[model samples]
Target: MKHALVFVASPDDKPAYREALLMLGRVALSRKLPPPDVLSGWESAQWIYDSVDGELRQEAAAAVAELPVDWALTPVAGRKKKLLVADMDSTIINVECLDELADFAGIKAEIAAITERAMRGDLEFEPALRERVAKLKGLATEALQKTYDERVRLNPGAATLVKTMAANGARCVLVSGGFTFFTERVAEAAGFHASRANTLLEDATALTGLVQEPILGRAAKLDALRSEARALGVSEQDALAIGDGANDLDMIKAAGFGIAYHAKPLVAAEADAKIDHMSLEAALFFQGYRRGEFVS
Candidate 1:
């Protein structure tokens, strides 16, 4: 089947330069394919080669890797997904919300170590999250608002990816193991259709050190993908899931295009796709959308 080799580079890298495109074209030729369809933009490019087998695609992808760019080769069919599911901490935004919350409680190092272990798949997500949140006991409720205001920043291309996909009639959902407080704000900022996350319990003045029961962990993330796909009247194959932690594994595996976005080592190794060197907008390119076609 026909597949696309999508290459993206940061502005400083300029891997979409003329010579790089020429080299990519040559690489396609070496794979016994005609010159590729070059979907070049300011910072990325997509080389659509005709009917290349998976083995050939891998070889072509390896050749392109020598350049300062990231690439993904996927079947042409269903390249344009109708649903977008994403994780919050460390994936959509820069910092782990829990770790930031931990800082407010003066236990950032301890909580962060647990976070690292869980994200790396060395610890169970639900128990790990509960343990971490427990450490934040008695933290002022006001600190939640302050943390969101001062610490949270969207990852590059987050808005572009969500706005572009949602603008194109795709159902964009932010499903995070993080708290609903952050997901609500993030969904609004990034233009997602809806958001779902764990609810952090709090009293009048401070956190109760408890999250609502049945913590939304790895399994729940997958369930969100399935549920969202059902609500959107689409199958799982028409969806794209992106995240950076072990909790994102099931959802990533369930979606048609599961991307590990600057992920932990375990996730990066297992996801169907990965984006280590580019922004979330590269997900659009992975679906064969040209740069000009992006809605935002």
Candidate 2:
């Protein structure tokens, strides 16, 4: 039997698994008697249905194509992901770093505008990152931790996703364009195996207003994937990546399964799977996991 993964994207609507299975069956039967083996997974509000059928693989592949913002079709074994690397801002959590920092700087509206351009692929993320960080100059560095306490919020199902992945023997790595200070705490709370992000420099109990050079951008986010893959004894094909900005392209392209979660148009167009309509748990489908079987 050959495998097929069907993902539905519509962040605003969640479909019932029973109903989705029924509809999928109708779609498959409409092609003739190519009955198949199926595995299922879900997140946010959508369900992913995987079917194995040698006779109808081609037709099934065509049927599910372009039905959503992002979907992945692969041989069942080919789609299984052994590692998951996720972005923190607007991903594992709902807030963007620079936008929140702007709030602290009393220029929330202005910085948020810059952030919008950057996330939408309109502005370069590295330069925008620098400009935003520069604005934070002179703010007490302790504010970083305060931001962690007041603004760093986890998205729905984020904890479930990480804990579930880890329990299943998959390594969960939290990579971010934000900062290591927050990434560290997020890793602990989410039960992540490890994490990487830009370091915010501080001295004398105040903001240094500087990020250590060689910041982690999209390129660096990609490097975290490679680094984690090696640590986990896997190849690029053994990895999965999820993020919501232009900077995530590198890791997404290199991974076995790249997911765009509530992403901008640019990211959704290119990733292996997209899950804007649901929670982070939706990623389990690429790993061949079913909702009932989810560890958490």
Candidate 3:
């Protein structure tokens, strides 16, 4: 099959730094492949080559491992997906909403520890979430808004990634195990077409310390990916999924192109590609979109 090896660097990197690494990448890839198509001047590029299965991913990784550029090897056919399904918490936003909400309850440390374990796949997601929400019981619902206002910020290139893909006609959806309170706001903030998440049941003034039944966990995330794809009249193979936690693994694996964006160990290990050195926009470049074609 014909494949593309994409190299992406941080947009904030100095010109000299970007140029030096891209130069190294060109030199390394040219030895076994043709000259690359520059996706972004000195920032991103792609080298197309014919390979069986993906024997070249490891070779390409070794060639550029010493440099700071992030790379992805994907088949040239169907590189541009029709749908984008991304996770919320640490994937789209900087901090976990639940953890920040816990800060207002004076239990941020305890809640954050459980969050880490859940994301790392050490504990069951549904049970872990229930345990965390249980601790936030009796807390004023106003803290939810406070957390969004003070602690929730999109990760680098998040808006650009979503807006660019949406402008190009892809249906983008934000699916999360986090509460709908954050996902709805985040979906609007990031310009996603729609969003899905678990709901936190609250009383007139405070949280009831309970979540709606049938929580949106790992299985739910995968279901969202498929259902969204179906709504677009496409198969799961026409979708692109990216996330950073163990709960995201199912959808990540089910998508045509699965990406781990600074993900946990298990997710990073199983993903088709990982964006460890670049921003979220790296996902765009991996799909053969040029920098000039980006919407934001």
lDDT of each: 0.85, 0.73, 0.89
Model 3, stretches more than 4 Å misplaced? Answer: 11-32, 52-54
Worst 10 residues of 1 by lDDT: 11-20
What value does the lDDT take at residue 11 in candidate 3?
59
Q: On lDDT, who's better, 1 or 3?
A: 3
Residue-wise C-alpha lDDT for candidate 1, range 1-296, written one tens digit per residue: 66787677666755355555666767776767655555655566665666765476567566666666667878888888999999999889999998998888888999999999999899999999889888888999998999999999999999999998888889999999999999999999999999999999999999999999989999999999999899888999999999998999999989999999999888888787789878888888888877888776
lDDT of 2 by residue, 1-296 (tens): 34454553343534543344455556656645354344433321222234444544445435444344333455566465679899999999879866776687798998888888988889988888888888888887767777888988899879988888788778999999888888899889888988888987778877676888888888888888998899878999988888988999888889988888888999988887677655676676545566676766
Where does candidate 2 stray beyond 4 Å?
A: 7-23, 33-72
TM-score of each: 0.95, 0.83, 0.94
Deviation (Å) of 156 in candidate 1? 0.7
Which candidate tops lDDT? 3
> How well does candidate 1 match the true structure in TM-score terms?
0.95
Model 3 lDDT, residue 134, Cα: 97
Question: Can you give the lDDT of residue 42 in candidate 2?
Answer: 34
- Residue 65's C-alpha lDDT in candidate 2? 45
Compose the digit string of candidate 3's lDDT tens values, residues 1-296: 88787788765666634664556466546556666778887678787777634346666677677777778888899889999999988889999999999999999999999999999999999999999999999999999999999999999899999999999889999999999999999999999999999999999999999999999999999999999998889999989999999999999999999999999999999999998878899999999999889887
Name the weakest run of 10 consecutive residues (lDDT summed) in model 2.
Answer: 40-49
